[model samples]
Target: MNNLLLNKRIVISGAARGLGLSFATACAKQGADVVMLDILADEVHSQANLLKKQGLKATAWQIDLADASNIKSTIDNVIAHSAQIDGLINCGALATGVGGKNMMDYDEDLWDRVMQINVKGTWLLSKALVPYLKASSAGKIVNIASDTALWGAPNLMAYTASKGAIISMTRSMARELGEDNICVNCILPGLTIVEATAYVPQQRHDHYVNGRALNRKQYPEDIDGTAVYLLSNLASFVTGQNIPVNGGFVFN
Candidate 1:
C-alpha cells in the first residue's frame, strides 16, 4: 500500500462487484476512506464489511443511479457521515447482459435504459458531488468509460454510445471545474475479466486478445492504478482527458 491517497476520501458507484469492487479495494488500500454505492444492498454491504475486516475504511450504500432524488439523498448521507470527499469514481452502469443486440435491432426500452443509467447517472452523481468536491483542496472525478466506444464494437451500440457520451462529458466537466482545482477525466478500459462480462461472447473476448498488442486478457487490477493515480496528487494538473487503457487494442 503506497498510501498515495492517505488522508483522502473517495466515493465509487457500482461498488457491489466487478471493477467497482476492485476500484474500491484498490483505493482503500491506498489509505482512502471509501463510500461504496451500488443497487445491490446486501452484496454491497457484505463487501464493505469484508473490507472493514481487512482493516480498511469502507462504507457501503445501496443506490439506484437512475433516480435523481436517490442520488441527492445518498450524497447527503455520505457527507453527513464522512465530510471532505476528495474523489469520485463513476463505475456503475448497465453492462451485464446488455449486449448481443445490433444497433438497428436494439430494443427501445433497453437502449433507453443504457442511456438513463450509464450516461445520465454519471451526470447526476457528478453534478450532485461537485459542490462537495469543490470544497476539497484537490478534487478529482474519474468516469469509467470503455474501449468499446473507441473501437466501435458492433452489436453493442447502446452500451458503446453511452460510454462514448461519458468520454465527451468528462472533457466538458473538466473545462468547467478546472478553475476550482477539480480534475475530471475518463478511463476507457478494455474488456476486462469480471463478473459483469460473463455474458460477453467468447468471440468478442478473442477479438480483444488477438487485437491487443499485449495479447492477453485485461483485468480490473490492470487499470486500477490509473484510477488511483488520477485520484492522487500525481494527476493534479491533468484534466479533461480520455485515456484508453485497453492494452493497445485501440490507440486513443
Candidate 2:
C-alpha cells in the first residue's frame, strides 16, 4: 500500500460509479477508509462490498443530492459511524440529457434540476460537513468541476454554468476554511468516457478527443492520480486552485 492517505477517513459523493467510484478505490488503495455515497443504493453497496473483499475499509450510503434534508441526515449518520472525516470528494452532480441544447432551448426544469443538484447540492453538503471536517487534523475538499467551465463549451450552458459556480465556490471556501486547516480545491476534468457519459453524441466525443493535446480518450482512471494527490499530504499547501485533468484540453 502507498499509505499516502493512511488512517484517513474520506467521504466520496457519487461513489457508486464513474469518477467517484474511481476516487474511492484509489483512496482506499492508499490506505484511506472510504465512505461511498450515491443515489444508487444497490450499486453503491456492491461497490463497497467489492472494496471490502479487497481487504479495504469501505462503506456505502445512499443519498439524493437534490434533497437537503437527506444530505444532512446522511452526513450526520456518516459522522456518527465514522467518528471523523478527513477529506471529501464532491463528485455528486446532475447532468442528465441537458447537453446539446442552445441556451434559449434549454428546458427550464432540467436547468433547475441541474442547478439544485450540481450547485446548491455541492454547497449544502460541504456546508453540512464543514464542522466535522474542521474537527479533523487534516481536512481537504476536492470539488469536481468541468473543463467546459474554463472554456465555455457550446450547447452545455447549464452544466457549464453550474461548474463555473463550483469553481467560484471553491475559491471562497478555501479562504473561509483556511483558518480551520481545511484545504479546498477544484478539479476540472475533461470529457471522460464513463457510463454516465455514454449518451454523449459521437460528434461531441470526437470534438473533445481531437481538440485535446493528448488527442486520445480520457477515462475516469485518468483523474485518480490528481484527486489522490489533492487529498494527500502532497497537496498540503495547495488550496483555492483549479487543476485540470482534461488531457490538456484547456491550458492553465
lDDT of 1 at 194: 97
Candidate 1 lDDT score at position 33: 95
After superposition, candidate 2 runs with Cα above 4 Å error: none
TM-score of 1: 0.98
Which tens-of-lDDT digit does each residue in 132-244 have in candidate 1?
89999999999999988887899899999999999999999999999999999999999999999998889999999999999999999999999999999999999999999
Residue 226 lDDT (model 2): 92
Native-to-model Cα distance after best TM-score fit, residue 213 in candidate 1, in Å: 0.7
What TM-score would candidate 2 get against the native?
Answer: 0.98
- Which clashing pairs does model 2 show? none
Error of 1 at 54 (Å): 0.7
Candidate models: Cα lDDT each = 0.94, 0.94
lDDT of 2 by residue, 1-252 (tens): 288999999999999989999999999999999999999999999999999999999999999999999999999899889778999999999876779889989989999999999999999999998998999987999999999998999999999999999999999999999999999999999999888798889998999999999999999999999999999989999999999899988998
**Whole-model alpha-carbon lDDT for candidate 1:** 0.94
Error of 2 at 235 (Å): 0.8
